[model samples]
Target: MSEQVPQLQQDPQQILEHVFGYSAFRGPQQAVIDTLVSGRDALVLMPTGGGKSLCYQIPALARPGCGVVISPLIALMQDQVEALQAAGVRAAFLNSSLPFNEVQDIETALLHGELDLLYLAPERLLQPRTLELLTRIELSLFAIDEAHCVSQWGHDFRADYLHLNCLHEQFPRVPRIALTATADQRTRGEIAQRLDLEQAEHFVSSFDRPNIQYRIAQKNNPRRQLLQFLRDEQQDNAGIVYCLSRAKVENTAEWLCQQGFNALPYHAGLPAQMRAEHQRRFLREDGVIVVATIAFGMGIDKPDVRFVAHLDLPKSVEAYYQETGRAGRDGEASTALLLYGLEDVVKLGQMAAMSEGSEEHKRQERNRLNAMLGLCEITSCRRQALLRYFAEEQLEPCGNCDTCLEPPQTWDGTQAATKLLSCVYRTGQRFGASHVIDVLRGSENEKVLKFNHHQVSTYGIGRELSANEWKGVVRQLVVRGYLEVEGEFQGLRLTEACRPLLRGEESIELRKLPPKARGERGESRRDSVAADIDPADEPLWQALRGCRKQLADDNGVPPYVIFHDATLRGMVQAKPQTPDQLLAVSGVGDSKLERFGEAFLTVLRESQAAPVEE
Candidate 1:
């Protein structure tokens, strides 16, 4: 039997004071930290602001020696290293971005035991020479950031991650921790299996970011709609605008910049140096709008982004959430604007159908995309619908979204739903939403004329609603359980839930599409950086972040390893006076309390005295 590890008996607050100079832990950080510090493996799924990094960073520092962090993106490694250096920790990275001398210098530091933490790409870690070198060092632990990449089903799969099982084979004694912001059930299982973490403890945070208001607009006059969104709701805050094509990325950025906002374009096609320069400028300069494909946002560490606007529909809600999560990482209020058309949905559906995954994966992707479409088209609380997609039950509506702001007028759609369903069944359910809508509206359009749908009994009965209104009704019907997408036919079909409506056994209430004028209740807020954040408080956040950075640097861990924003927020809020008091905060274990705890306590005391003057 495995020995039961003796529990460390230090106060969390004191550990926080000594190691991270914090007085508290936020959300599940303490629980997660405890699991890791106990020398066990853990798989963490937390939101962007949920402080996932601290779960491993602090524990790495509390442990005996250097920790290795396997990160996918070289740019991400550099950003992490810089942040750690700012906090006064010994940190270095090995990636292709570095020159030979720099890489050798970092390796020498690792060999000489001069570094506490080292960030490496999976490819580098798997290198024979690198593995040979690591055999000489006394490693403390291993951490994998963005663990979802290990699964091919994931949005950002990296083939190199599949080789990480070598870490367990070579360093059997070292503990392992894998962290990611997003993963569905299947992806989670795949991660555990692929990374050889089957026995690891699992920590899943609620996948809801309530502070972000969700909105989806029909793709009509998209540029105009985006401009209106910027003018009405954005409040001149900086945001990322995602496009599907590089050409669109360039055009949109240039147009926005011409309109007097500081906008820039970034895409894979651009020169690497130019992309890096622009990204740095956006990070350092506030209120700069970035228009790019998905290339610009991932691995971006900017914290004060107020919004994430997409001019095109993302492939899935997972992509949407991960992209949007970039906004408001500072834990402030933000918005997620999605503009898509029928064409966009069709295109995505085709792509999903074409993917070389399992039938179940394709079905799930379609369902997720449909859910996203429902979120966009609904005249209800976007936040409520989004939470529901994650299987969360929310009765009370969020008052911030467009629907909640302008309440939708619902009517009894029992008769209308019956008519729509009947038409689908009679027509063999072989067509998509548009054809169904056309059939109902009695349009003499080409498809309708060809199908001779103007002669059907149900034809012309829906003239009371416009084509757009009919589209909304059909979409809403599908969401409300009266209909389902027929996978084989690639069309809409009635579900068992529709039986009651058709048989007059039940009544369905349908909300009328709000007037275009009504939907225009709020103008885009300014498209500039946020003004409400106290620039003065930034220094304190930076100082606390600095302490976090140093701890991570010294331990060769991610900054979040030291303490999460919530814990740091607690310290900034409570500034404890002693190590014993620090131990009271969450995320500080006895081992952490005994190791390097005094150093953090000193920083906290010193920080409190100077108070990080702005």
Candidate 2:
């Protein structure tokens, strides 16, 4: 290395306060930083909005030489570097987004020991020249973001993540830290194994986001359901609506915009420019909703998102949790609304059958789908059911989910279920839900009549209930193990568990969706950012946000990079009078206080003098 910063005293607490503008480390952060600084590896499984970045960022500043971050995507790298640079940290990234000359400049900075941290895409970092040059430098430590990508079974598996084991092989002496917001025990073990951090200390933070209110409804009219939810419950909120297919994403986005919502579509099928532009708007603008497939939101850092709606079923519980976890990142009151039905299960099954993975892999995927179905159909606390899937639990019912807030009613569906099961049996179990529903509703549809099944005794018996109700019964049957999906036939079949109910030897109670639960429920608390400000400080909050927006626009980064809403909330709560007083705010790192502290103090002072409205 050409030269290094003069040796300076370093401690995690000192770095936390002076470099990051935080007074203390969040859960397990201090321990993680201490471990990495002492020349050891650490595996941290913190939830979203849990400050996982600081687990390594603080240590990167405290240690000598430069920290190397192996990020997954170019956009993520760019965002991180912009945020860090805004914080007055000398950070740079070498990615395809950078032009040739810019890449050369970043490389020079790394070699000359001028950068505090460097972000590299694994594919580029593993190249011969990049690896050789990195070997020539004096390195501090490595931080692997989105570490779950290393697991083959994960929703966002990346082939390049499989090659990260070389980090241990090449820089054997440099300490390392791997971080992910979503990972069950299995994924965690796989992450540690694949990254060659088997000897690292593992920290598992609780996988709960209490501020997010959970709700799920049967998908009778998904578009109308989502629009109604948006209009009634959480209008003017930035959110994400996830669909199962690219076509659905496009249709939903168009439909939403026609209804006067600022909606955008994001999927792999779209052109890269279009996707980037849409993501930029969703990140930088206020109250914009992006209707997307699961391909988006892997590395997003937006903290003020108010909702995440699912138009169709996700492939796995982990995928569902990770996607919904995207909302309420700032610990604000938010909503995760899902609308699912029999179609979701059938579609997921068909996709699994058509997938190219090994039979064992397909089987595991199918099991995961079934687990997601269980979560949707659960009559108890949605949060508890969700947490239990990840091997976590809550001591009591969480009042934040639909089931717990307005408990669902149950009815003896044994009779309705019997008719549905018998319809499947008498039809030779050769029909999917639509055909079966037609048969049950006594429709003389071509398929049902063509199959010579109109004479079946069970036909028309389910006509008492509407077509939608019958579909609900079938869905519940499938969830309760009374019926099973046959991949080869693309049809439903009666399971052994159906015999007891069919013979009247057993009773089954299916959940009845409470009408009250579907209606709007009052938020348990005000928005975290909005609640922190007094009525007198509301003007100041707006001024601070406006200042942040301007700075973010000038710097060409998201507003949160300048100062997160939490930081702004702290400023309003403390009402700091001077730059020195401003340093006491949670996110006011010394560099930030020096750069933007004076401007914020001016706003606070001006707000105090403004006349109050009667």
Candidate 3:
């Protein structure tokens, strides 16, 4: 009801109520939204699902005419546009997915000032025709979604985003807001510069998703581990199971379905209709499991997904974080499960080395992959370790993950770590984890024999630990900074931190990884919102929305302009039986009350009240 803007440019609280139907804004949403609506640019580095969309979407609506949204993915644009439409915002999109006629229709609507927002892929926006059309439209502001794509080092980089600078060039008067769910300092600079927003404000939210439980499992019996995770931790919960290959995606989906879950496969290799069907099923049906490859997630908008299980290691931590954050969009608790092994690390490393990037880019990619590997092998509290990698400080352990819930046994691993480091040193630190492991086990393989690694004093010293256990120890050492893997030629090398352990100057505590426990079996609670509502209020709210939608259609406006969900909630509580009474509601201006209040109040009057206790 308050009309005053915080900081004189944005009223994020009001935007929260009016556009997003929420009573309050989440962390950093208010501040970032405030900066942008005040006619300034902002570089936002938030974790996925950290309400990044609301930062721009709400301000776009609150400001004025159509907001031009430049997004990276066509699929993402489509999903966002659908969500905005569902919430009764006059939103549309023009992308490769739309036919010429549909594009023309949207263009006409934009020219007529009928749309509040228009979403476009960066590639489409760069086209001369699209740019020309944008110049003629009543533009309120420019919003760049997934702005990190402009950075060459970013995981999802697209060359087209570099052209977004033209918006700033052409429309210097229009305030530009660039937003991304994932970005480090490097990517942030690229976003600001590439979008010509160096002078824009920067709003960096903490990179934290406290609601999502992070877990990593050794890939031994991964299928079984995944099944158990689903059965125990996520029984009858909506989730996505990601695989690296299409064949694996299909097989995993089939396996899950055979195990009596509502499983479906989705991959770029699938028939278009099949992919769409699986996506629809995942969205509409409760507790359906979508077994998919990386191609499936960029555009997904499902809010109540309970879990995201990775059957293989993700290419990088950024990609993993973004994919897993899809669960628990409603601010409820969720889980992100990763199943990985040394092979996964090697595969990812090899893939990174093969990508068509410059040497420096490849090196950074390897660093990111190594960080993911460290996460998989970390013995400390999973959340603390993950948050720390993102440069966040955490004082205590999160008591939700497998490591924290069932603490692993601690053993002094200083000697073993020293021995591992010695092997790397003696071998000239010129190999991968597997070769290091082979040398530690005193393998007489061709490579080991050719290098004469058996001559080292530390050779076969690790015979006391199993290959798997030794690997866990070595991985912990890497993650803990006792050792570092050199990116050039994928060398396993020791860092200065290793000096203390090797010299007995420090003792290293290692947790003996226990066998992963299976998740709860059988169907559990699925989105159990209270079925009961105030009987008088239910129909009235529905009727209000209905009337609003009808008015929106008649006037070529969005339903939210008539009444947002917050207003509807207020109406239900106030139970205003007449337009005059409705006009007394907090947000009701006389003009709006006169124009649209009577129809909603009529519906409110017709609704029956629930029986009240005396």
For all candidates, what are the clash counts?
A: 44, 2, 6
Model 3: per-residue lDDT, tens digit, 1-614? 12222233235566555445466677888887777666777777777767778887877777767888887766667667766665567899887777899988999999998998999887788889888988887676788887877888876778888788998788877778888777766677778877888898788777777777777777768888887666655677788999999999999989999998999999899998788777766765557899998888764666667889998889877788778878776556678888877556656777888899899989999888878876776667988877776667789998877678766577877778788888888888778877888889978999888888888877787888777888787667766767665565667778887886778777877767675454432234342221223654566666776777687677554344455444666787788887667766655645566667777777777664544447
Candidate that would win on TM-score: 2
Predicted structure with the largest lDDT when compared to the true one: 2
Look at candidate 3 and tell me the lDDT of residue 127.
85
The residue ranges of model 2 lying beyond 4 angstroms of the native Cα positions read 1-9, 444-452, 487-489, 523-528
TM values, all candidates: 0.76, 0.95, 0.76
CA shift at 514, candidate 2, in angstroms?
Answer: 3.7
Residue-by-residue lDDT tens digits, candidate 2, 248-309:
99999999999999999999999999999999999898889999998889888888898999
* Candidate 3: clashing pairs of residues: 228-519, 231-520, 232-519, 232-520, 233-519, 233-520
Whichever of 2 and 3 has more TM-score, that candidate is: 2
Between candidates 1 and 2, name the one with more favorable TM-score: 2
Predicted structure 2: lDDT: 0.85
